[model samples]
Target: MATCEPLYWRRCRSPIGWFEVGEPALIGPDAILYAMKKVQLIRDKLKTSQSRKKSYADVRRRELDFLVDDWVFLKVSPVKGVMRFGNKGNINPRYLGLYKILKRFGKVAYELELPVELAAVRPVFHISLLKKCVGDPASIVPLESVVVKDSQSYKDVPVEIQLV
Candidate 1:
């Protein structure tokens, strides 16, 4: 029990400069003033950083929300289902579907009612992946037949072949 209580704290230099820990002088008025200054400096820096981040995010972040039964189009990323989308260079659909929001899972996530054809993909999606669908018949396009081979791969049916 005596060993637990420190008779005298041995002063040691911290790896970081401009500050020292476990020193007897830390209890002095000067040390208190120094610590307060450091805290104020840190608080000011944090405030500036937070404002900068808020401005950066506000520039690009789109605030979208959906109530239950709201129709939304899910974005199709090029990285996902590469075979189904095809390796035919740059032509790839950015968004797919008019899936309905079944339930709101969280603030930024919702459970969608995807068709039976898309059973392989997850039903829950983040708000970023969804776009609030405007009822425009001209905007909707039919997807071509691209047979999925099992759960792992997809085989795109050749629409045409040309050789020069």
Candidate 2:
């Protein structure tokens, strides 16, 4: 003998329109519970699939290694006054001479010798803010290739300054 099942309905209203659920409900309470379980199973499967699709091979952490007497390009924020009038600020991406990397503090912070003019301000910077100057390229071909010979020689040379 077949038994009659209780029907369930869900109603939702939004600014744009109204949505109704459980239209033409024909399943028993046990069947409805089973369908809900199936829906949850599908959701869990989708989450696992999406997580598996993520690749971390190309994702790299930024690394900046600065040593004493190494040349580095400092990224300075534009001064307010210079930015206000649309002037290219003084610290605009210029390759300054290799300043001696005085000391390294913590993992990402460092203290360096800055030009006398900039000495009035703080000279410490995070490693992320500094880029090692690998020297200018002599020429450009189909592919961007570094002048290895020049870079190797530059790396070998050390910065020397006499202290008064």
Q: Residue 63 deviation, candidate 1, in Å?
A: 2.8
lDDT of 1 by residue, 68-150 (tens): 98889888777765535333566777777688899998799999998887788889999999999876534454655445567
lDDT of 2 by residue, 7-88 (tens): 1133323212222454554556677677667556656776686566654432555556778666676665555543222135
Instruction: Report the Cα lDDT for residue 22, model 1.
Output: 54
Worst 10 residues of 2 by lDDT: 1-10
Once model 2 is optimally superposed onto the true structure by TM-score, how far is the C-alpha of residue 152 displaced, in angstroms?
Answer: 34
Cα error of candidate 1 at position 32, Å: 2.0
> Local error of candidate 2 at 3, Å?
46
TM-score of 2: 0.38
Error in Å for residue 18 of model 2: 33
Each model's lDDT comes to 0.70, 0.56
